[model samples]
Target: MRGLLFSSSKASSPSNSSTQSPARTPVSTPHHRTFSASIQEEDLLYAEQVIRRWDLDSPFYTKLDSLFTGDRREARQFVKSVKNLQSAMHFFVSESASSEKLIHAQKLMQVAIKRLEKEFYQILSANRDVLDSESVSNRSSRARSSVSNSDSDEDDRISTWGTSVSDGERATVSEMVMADLKSIADCMISSGYGKECARVYKILRKSIVDETIYNLGVKKYSLNQINKMDWETIEPKIKTWLHAEKIAVKSLFSGERILCDYVFSSSEKIRESCFSEICKERAVTLFEFPELVAKSKKSMERMFRSLDMYTAILEHWPEIEMIFSFKSTTAVCKQAVASYVKLGDAVRAMLTGFESTMQKETLKTPVHGGGIHPLTRYVMNYLVFLSGYSEAVSDILADGPLQVHSPLPESYFSSMTSDDSSSISGRFAWLVLVLLCKIDAGAELYKDVAQSHLFLVNNLNYVVSKVRNSKLRLLIGEDWVAKHEQKVKQYCWGKLSFKFNEAYRKHSTWIISDRKLRDEIKISLSRKISPAYRTLYERYRGYFQGVDSVVRYAPDDLGNYLSDLFHDAGASGSTHSSSSSRYLSRGR
Candidate 1:
């Protein structure tokens, strides 16, 4: 009968005996019979009473678990229950319970706690979707509000949101999760499960941070899209939006370094948008200057104003670069340089066109009374005006470091010491040189050598005088004016030596037997050549005295002949002869 009962007891035991045994025992051990024999019925009853007590408390633990896992509830109840359960287990272990009973009760509590920890993690994982959805919905609502509101309303809304977020008037899903996790962690810490608590909190914190960064990225992308739109129509709106975002972010995260990065990135995008539009407008205006300048003086002024606007925009590049920590200052400066170069090209084209027009006019005008044509005066005046502003123009054009430094030849202009040919000052100097060369070339088109020399003298004198009288003297220098003045003197000398002296040599011996005919012929010759001869005599009076002895006319009577040089060719023959005789007696 005893063997049968023992066999029955073994049969009733669990098939997986290892799982049913204590955690410290091995599955292959043959101590089951001895272990069963050691447990008294009184110890079994006590173990049963402990387990019954736990079962009775299951409803409370289940309710606490539900409350802790529920959204929008404080975790105080769950924390208190965990503390109570740990206390109860300690109390039960300290009572007069047998060893087996105490061990069994400890194992039961440990199992319950482990299950609760597993449920806690599962709840955290399950709530992730809710947290994500809440974050997405909040972002969407803010975006919608921003889009629908006017500027004033938008400002107010942003201010309100910033205040609410700062003051914690509105709680995010992450905040709620963190609050619950902190409670759970505290309970676990008290129960000596600190490592598990740390692991859960680390994961939750990482997820919250990642979600925040993603949301911020989405907001930044939206602003970028708005920034890239048409600048003229949307620039104000974009600026206002950026300002609001800056305020919002600053208020929301006042001490966070991340806010600085976000603001800088958004500002960079705004600056890029403005820069791109400015560049495009500058290019279009530069290419269109030829037509615009032809329309009116106001059109040219407008073009310059546009250039100033582009320069103003470019000036902001340094501030933008510094704020954003950008590495593209060189590239931005290149854009500024390109715009100035285009401006230089436009000015060059206009000057070339003006030169062409002046050349045609100069070829038709005679160089007797005033020498220079009206067109020549206009061109010289314009060049002087341009040179006066050369310094200002150079400042506008030269924003970057000098790149080219080839030495200019000595013959070009020794006073111009700057070797940076890429600079605006260098370019302006080249333009002035080009215009001067054009004027010199135009002088060669005259039919007579004397007239050509006279033309050069008049133009060069005008340029030198204007430069001396204006700010251009500072740019071109006194030496440049002196050099051109020397050229004018050389031209005057050439006209005298070639035109006046040669004419005198050809007509020196024109004598007629008839006194009336002789006087008439001499009077005619005097009218044709006296002005140049008198000019030469006045210029080289004492120096050419020995040479003048070989000439037909005596020095005493030269001024009398010179005074009748411009008499009309169709004047009465008697009147011309009388006028010459009257000037000759006055000369004596």
Candidate 2:
């Protein structure tokens, strides 16, 4: 009766329609004519036959129902059957069929399945907690069983649920995830969260297997495609894609965290091997996650800090080499270097020492006095010099220069002319000039510049005080003390020396508050530059007047000082814009 109900309805619907709407004017015209509901009934009858033939009360149907209800046991079975169905669909989804009608039918089937999946997910979500707990318990139990029954076929059966999905189904799943990611990406773009969306995209990218999808999205549709997507229609799919991404990322972090804890907590070679393996795994596809690199670096730092609690690990493992290879390590090193360069001498020294200690250095060299880590130092200097050049050039280009001042002094005054002067002798004259020019050249020269500068000053003051204090100890006959009287005289005679607190305190006051000092500084710097700069209009002289095969400004050695200077300037900063600004300045 259920399958044949349409046979009786077809003969009865037309007569009832005409009589039922008597209050309305019925037209005999074809457009207004009523049709029998029998065709609709027949169509429903046909669909019910396929559905009922599958037997909704069967064990398979009950399992599917439980799957939709979030039972892990049932879900596993459901997935196996779904995988079989997907293999069957591959002839439709992935391969061209012989008949167009069959192709259309296949598409209808796919749509129906997707709709079913949507309904299933909705039911699962409504009972998410129950499903989540079941999934965790099931997963844990499976993991234990896998270890216990390594050779058993049951383990294979369980593993095959996700891993045994047909290639076609896996591809289809990837396609589905990609499609959903695209929708979420579009939503993100339209909602004015493009940057955050990009971050999320980076995190989700490696989860999807098809690189071709990303390539197509980026190259063909571009970011504009996101705005054109139907988010309301695709939102559930997006959530599924996001869920997959979360699962993948969480898995990666779990492995990373476990290894990190083991490597840091124990000195055992096996544990270190495990940790190294984990780090390598994280790095294997790291390029796909550019946005997560920043956060990962922070996480690694915390991880490394925990390692201190286990000193035996430090003694046994080559952690320095291992850590540096981590993406997080490089990022942290970059941040630390920036902080170090701008920090006060004391803090900078401390940080520098820490950095050096972390290194697996083969050679020993002094790192103080701007010579710390020749490669790093060179990078810093080049960047700073380039910045100064940029500032000088910008000033030159800004306006008509009617007046100019003298070059910077060859020798800066270490002592004040007046005894009561309240300034610091060490104004970081060269460094300050370099920094000012860098700032004027439109570079964010220092992130925490002021604080770092002050710290350096305090550190220098501390060192100088320590030296003075040691001098006082000489009066008490300490063997460690050098000849105090001669040392005092020599330091006093030195033009770089200050009259203790009097000279520096005065200079510090003036340098801190006086605008004229900056102007004077600018003037002094301009004047002290090479004489060639002042003679820009007239340069007719040749240096080979005596018939020697020589060049002007050429040194006996081959290296160009100016070129080296510029090269060093470029090394100070990583960003191209910042490096470019460095070369436009002259004095600094």
Candidate 3:
């Protein structure tokens, strides 16, 4: 009786029984179609209800399957069909069907699952091709779009896309591809297709990681963060993305590649920004520097502070290069050079204005009290201080390791001194020379040529002495001091030869004439010309006797009258006792 019932059930369900016989077949044939058509529509509906109950009872399978396959719109339909067929087979056999019938239905359902798995593989293969073509199209379109823009705007538009599928859409497609592959692999493994499952798993794993890198690591994160990057702020985000816990677990190599490209591209943008800011600051500071220098001590200090701040930016170059792996260190150094050049120009202009002001002041009134003029002292002090820091200035100017050569061996005042013309030191030396020339021209403004020469001697002596005593000596060199000292002596000789000796020759005979008349001439000469004449005669007469002028006075008489030249108590023609004089008492 049981055998008859089983045979009758099999006859009624020809599609299920026929397909069950083909489960062991290596290749699908017409029986596979008969198996698909064997399940009654009513039984399939009941199976769907049963599958829904299983979904509720074992939520893990549903959730896991959803996680692995949710990206594909068709994947859910395929999974639903598989679950419905499985449910219908279980439902039909349990409803009073014989044990053989039950076994046949299970076999038929297993064949359907294998067929569905095969179809899933084909779906994944098709999706991969579509995604590949789409990614290639996206890259090519982006390249074309970037090329269409100007070079200046190209960097800004480097990642812009013209496609209807935006970055987010591409990400979605990638996710779909990865999820579909994963679902197919998981289905193959559960169905005992070990070899096929391993092959699919490999592809699925790679796809997941590659997709994550392209979608999350590269496209999504970098596009959002790159434009806002700066020297101080860019590294953290890059590190976070590269070392992300999720990314590290899934695709460390892809993360590294993404990091490299992101850093390289972002750093290029940052470099341009840094250079632009540096140039802008340079131009603005240079425009305002002359006025700042002329205002007060505070203004000069502010200018120095400004330059220091600007120069400090160069110090970050190493860190930037390290982070970004910049191709050329020279690019960073050039920015520093440009900044230093502008700063040097501002310093030169300020000094030039200062020299002009000093010249006008010197012409208005003679500097007195045997001291250097205030303006000259200030200029020399500042320049001396500046020269002392030549090494630091050179570093700032060159933006790299720099050797500050000692002052030229030749005279600083020489027309042709060998200097590293490309260096900051050379520029500084030229500025100093120009200032000295201005000082030389300023000396001519004094009303008395002898006084003018005296003024030059005083200032030049002060400069030479200051330079010799300080670090400025290293920059101006020993020869510079000696040359200026010799200049001082030459001016002193001029004062004596042209102003004093000449006056003495013209007045000496008058000094020895009738005592009353000689006395009157001597009094007039003392007020107008005698002090300078006396100063030169007392100190330099012996040296100049044969060379500068003939001996104009007998030694004893000249000495006696020199002592009386500045006397105020005696009348203009009165003869004074010679013994009262200091020079006359010591006469040879």
Query: Alpha carbon lDDT of residue 24, candidate 2?
Result: 81
Q: List the residue pairs that clash in candidate 1.
A: none
**Candidate 3, number of clashes:** 0
- List the global CA lDDT of all models: 0.45, 0.30, 0.45
Predicted structure 3: lDDT? 0.45
Q: Of the candidates numbered 2 and 3, which has the greater TM-score value?
A: 3
Task: Give residue 368's lDDT in candidate 2 (0 to 100).
Answer: 38
Using lDDT as the measure, the top candidate is: 3
Separately for all candidates shown, the number of backbone clashes (residues 3 or more apart, or on different chains) is 0, 39, 0
Q: Distance from true position, residue 100, model 1, in Å? A: 61
Q: In angstroms, what RMSD does candidate 1 have relative to the true structure?
A: 20.3
Residue range 1-588, candidate 1, lDDT tens digits: 122224434544576454565886545444763454344333444434443433425554443334344332223423444455555444334333345644664565454456446545654565554334334234433333333333233222211111123223334543343334434444454565555544553355345434443444322223344334543534343334334323322322221112112111223433233223222222222223222222223223233333333343344444323322323223433444454455444444444445455434434445564366565576667766665555545654454323332344457656776554555545544545655665677676777776777677777667667767887777666777677666655565545444644553354333344556656766776666666566655764443334333333444455444433333444443354465555334422
Report the C-alpha lDDT of model 3 over 1-588, residue by residue, as the tens digit.
233345557755868666665667457467764564466455555444433432423444442243223333344444545545545544455354655545654554455444445544554454543344334233433333332333234222212111235565674454344334434433333334434434443354356445544454332323234334452343443333333322332233222222222212323433333223222222222223222222223224333433342333344334323322333333434443454455544444443444455444543456763346666687678767666556556665554322323343354555444646446656555545655665676676676776677777677766776777787777655666667766665666545345544554354333344566655765675566555556655664443233233333333444455545433344453354344243223422
How do the predictions measure up, each by TM-score? 0.34, 0.21, 0.34
Residue 375 CA error for candidate 3 (Å)? 3.6
